[model samples]
Target: MCNDSKIHGFLEKLPKCEHHVHLEGCLTPELMFTLAARNGIKLPDPETRPEFSSAESLYTRYENFTSLDDFLSYYFIGMSVLKQQDDYEALAWEYFQKANADGVHHAEVFFDPQEHINRGVLYDTVVSGFTAGCRRAEKEYGMTTKLILCFVKHLPASDASKVFDLAVERGDFDSGVVHGIGASSSEVGPPKDMFKEIYATAHSKGIQRTAHAGEEGDPSYISAALDAYKSQRIDHGIRLIDSPSLMERIVKDEILLTVCPVSNVKLRCFDHISQVPIRRFLDAGVKFSINSDDPAYFGGFILHNYCAVQEAFGLSIADWRLIALNSIEGSWIEQERKLELLKLVDEHIDKHLAD
Candidate 1:
């Protein structure tokens, strides 16, 4: 590991923006137990559900998932413990505090409404609590946040449309709390083309669009998301490197890729962190940023992701600066805020050099 104090200091001080984290995925086992007890829900028995046996055992099992499907089985189980608005608010608030301490000044968080609604949780309860949590984070930690409602692609398009309509009916699209729409989960059958109508509705309402594509899907999925869904940014677009033409298009269009190194490794997208192709993306002029897709499950947060990549790739201070700047630029925030964060990045880098 590169343990140079200067490099560590630079990473600690650099301002960051995390664009692709699932709020539910941020639930740690410690919090899981706390929330489960508060809600009077009993976690599955250890004999039957060894994954929930103990916090340490759960983490060990989390590290052993053979595929994305395996990880999600546990992911949904973690969601079941959350039943009320207070639960949701506490979840978001905890993430904000941890993210703030990690040097994240801005975060665009993803949440799956259908996951909660299918479990009998109301959409109003979810949004109201999450929005309140964002306000609290801003007030307490000066952390700017925006929520993105991610439609699970494995679900029917009609179901996703209902979620979109709910957001629209509640004026979430205009509320400034919910800033965008995204597609996530099981990118196998329901292609990005499936969400065309939903994206169109969001665009019509002036909400930003983004989607998870090319993590395990083909490069063509990335193309479909860009062309059909008109995605402003792509989450986990690491496979774009497979198609040089598509990569060129991404660079030309400047579609930002929120690449998660630890998630990629944990999900078996890459055999090791060194094989993640971050350097290749940099060389190709692709606009990309580091993120922690499902930090709790993937065993790393945004800062840990950055540090792992830095050590694996032996990234210089200049490289770290570009990555930090790309995160702010890729964020769905106002240009004024983007510029302000960029200035913070520059000042941090300059301070490190002077030291």
Candidate 2:
């Protein structure tokens, strides 16, 4: 295990790629209040909504979540503050700034379209604003980004299909900002099979597929996501450790599991970060990468997540390097770009070690 200072320095310099962050979930309370005032939206009463009393207060409330459902209730409440195109743009830009500062060169972020669209926010507005932010981040910070539109499981599959069609219709899918489609929200009863047709539609259109499974659900959910939905990646797939056969299939198939340790602990998936099954994945030779699923709510960004996991598990520099490599390899970017990023990682590590 590296010392705390070494780990901090190494993580700060590491070229990271986050694959599981939610764009909406990145809304910090400061930004939430800023946007709420700018949009003329009234926040809930502080007496009743003590979480909104202050940024720190809200964070404390987020920490008290008992389950995924409990956290998501507040997650949607925070998202309600977003109204216009500028709000979405600011949200994406804010997250990109944080990611860039954390040495994240590339990111594949998730956005819930149905959540906004159902609230009368136009699909085009969200895409246009978010893509504009992506452009700015590239120009300003050299941080490349791709937006993955996620379908909320609580909504009907038909609603998801409509959003997919709307994306295609508005040329968002073809605009290069939107690269993939996936599912999010409560993974309890809405099985992957429910969105099989939607996945098929996205596949036909050459869009990559992924889903949130096996975090709050069973290992069978992971299998269904892989076999039935044909997902190219699995988000929050920690529960796969429960089934050796399923774990073997994941290893043999080379499926990428985007494990978010901080979010898992915050949502009560595990009582503590030390209990997270990252070491299990490493021992089993299962391919996985660490990410901050919802940095704002989970009390850390990607870098904090890395540091926390390193300290908890006493991960060596080599282990951290492997996780970085897995993130780049498992990303939805082109092969040429992936190669270039991997080369950068090697160069960074060599320079750090020499020093």
Candidate 3:
């Protein structure tokens, strides 16, 4: 681990933006209990406890997963307590409070409306709660946020299309606060091409696009997502480096890679944090950003993500600054807002170094 206090200081002060986190995944155990008690929900006993319940243990006990399904099984349980608009509002508020505490200036959070809607929760109710919390965060905490409605790849493409239509009908895209469509969930089913029509519909309505790819699959999936979904960014694209041609393509296209390090360790993607290819990705000049994919389930927020990468990679102050720049480059914010953020990042870095 690195002992460079100077670099650590820079990392903590660097203005940051997150682009790959899930709202449901932000449910901390303390919040989980609060929501459960209020909603009259019950979690399984320890004998049948999901592995992700160990999330409360800082993910120290989740080392036995043999497959993504095993990881997701526990992941599903972690989000089961949410049942109403108040539940969603509390989840969003809690997540932003943590993000604000971590110095996150802007964030693009993913939401799975189907997770609630399939269980009979109203679509308007889901958006109302989330948007209310985000509005409150901006007014109260000074955090800027954007929402992305993500399609569950494990479900049929038709179902995703239906939800996409619902999102548009609800004026999610018209509001500018909800700006994009994303494909997430298990990557094993429903080829990326299956959602081409949905992406097209979203595009026609002026929504931007992104997709999850290359984390647990081959680089070809990344290609399909880009080609079919017309994605502007790739989430968890760590596997792209495995194929030099694909890596070259990513750089040439300027596609941003959103990386979540501690989550990778907890999910057993690599045996050690130092094995993460963050430096390698940077050296290759592939545009990328850092994020805590699921802070609650993975046991860290954006600051922890930065600190973990810094300690594992032994990044220098310059390296930390480069990462902050990459985050600005990858953000979907308007040019005026992005410039404002860049100025803030620069000012923060300068002030910290001078201190």
Candidate 4:
């Protein structure tokens, strides 16, 4: 087999799993307009306004965001059109179809409830609508999905706690639709300790926990998330590279870091693709997974993320294989399912080599 061709084919056919994707973040402009029209919401004119015309324009507008707050502003703006269950259902279904087309078999989807709730979109409205899509996606596409309810970090921890309690009380997560609790939003405000009590409550309820740390924050935040909340995963712990000791601890504990390369580029997390530390983490035996944090705005999905980094750094076939395996290792699926997916990935690589 031609080495590059074989590797490219394997990537296309790999049975992948994503651990760090946002629900509303996956809303494409095409679907955005469709949902807005159906919901009778008015979007800025795409005709007179050149910025809302296509995916390219949306990506250009998004790339200008310099901070987490800037990204959140647009993120919430695109989500404003989603006012009902059908809107949420359409978003979830659309994401699942895209994932399916990209060969993703399992995913742990993150949703920022605080964003929707503050906008008068009930917690159940967001949860149930996506839950409906998960059910249908499973039946129709053979995809397994789990939801991670994320707390907007800019909000007070007490408000985050309220959101968690509501999810539990309303039974929005009882059926495994909502499997874990996560922390997202601007990383600059509300130090990690702010969410200590909220994480404790989530821990007490037997819910899995994870947090976004070390993306734009200091390596100390990564330590805080693990030490304070005992998070099972760390989202975009990129700054962990700044501290050798913390990097060792993360690898020692086998905690997963859900790294979003495209989002990082758009948010200016790294100056260039070469600065991404995925290879460094891998070489050091740190567990990490690639994901598209906000694909709608970030110009690429999960596969595009892998392809971009792979080409940027001249990753070898073995490296790509390890990256694919890393995704399975970081997934929230059951052990049996994880094993099955690994086998499928291996089979895909083998088939590609044969071809």
Top lDDT prediction, candidate number: 2
Residue 133 of model 4 has an lDDT of 90
Comparing 1 with 2 on TM-score, the higher-scoring candidate is 1
Q: How close is candidate 1 to the true structure, as a TM-score?
A: 0.97
Where's the lowest-lDDT run of ten residues in candidate 3?
49-58
Candidate 4 segments whose C-alpha is farther than 4 A from its true place: 1-5, 42-57
lDDT of 2 by residue, 90-159 (tens): 9999899889988899989999989999989988899888888889998998777899999999999899
State each model's CA lDDT, in order.
0.88, 0.88, 0.81, 0.84
Residue 111 error, candidate 2, Å? 0.4
Q: Which one wins by TM-score: 2 or 3?
A: 2
lDDT of 1 by residue, 71-178 (tens): 888888898899989999998988888788789999899999998988789998999888888999999988889999999977788888998888888888887768
Residue 54 of model 4, lDDT score: 70
lDDT of 3 at 175: 75
Order the candidates by lDDT, highest first: 2, 1, 4, 3
RMSD in Å for all candidates: 1.2, 1.6, 2.2, 2.6
- Winner by lDDT between candidate 4 and candidate 2: 2
Ten contiguous residues with the weakest lDDT in model 2: 1-10
In the range 1-355, model 4's lDDT, one tens digit per residue, is 1236655666767788888999999998777877778878777788877777776787677768887788887787789888999889989988898888877899899988887788788888888899999999899988889999888877777778788777788776566768998988888767777888878877777789999999889998999999899899999999998999998999889998998887888889887777899779879998888888988878878778777787777777677788788889888789998899889988887777677
Tell me each candidate's TM-score: 0.97, 0.96, 0.93, 0.93
Best prediction by TM-score: 1
Can you give the lDDT of residue 193 in candidate 1?
92
Show pairs that collide, candidate 2. none
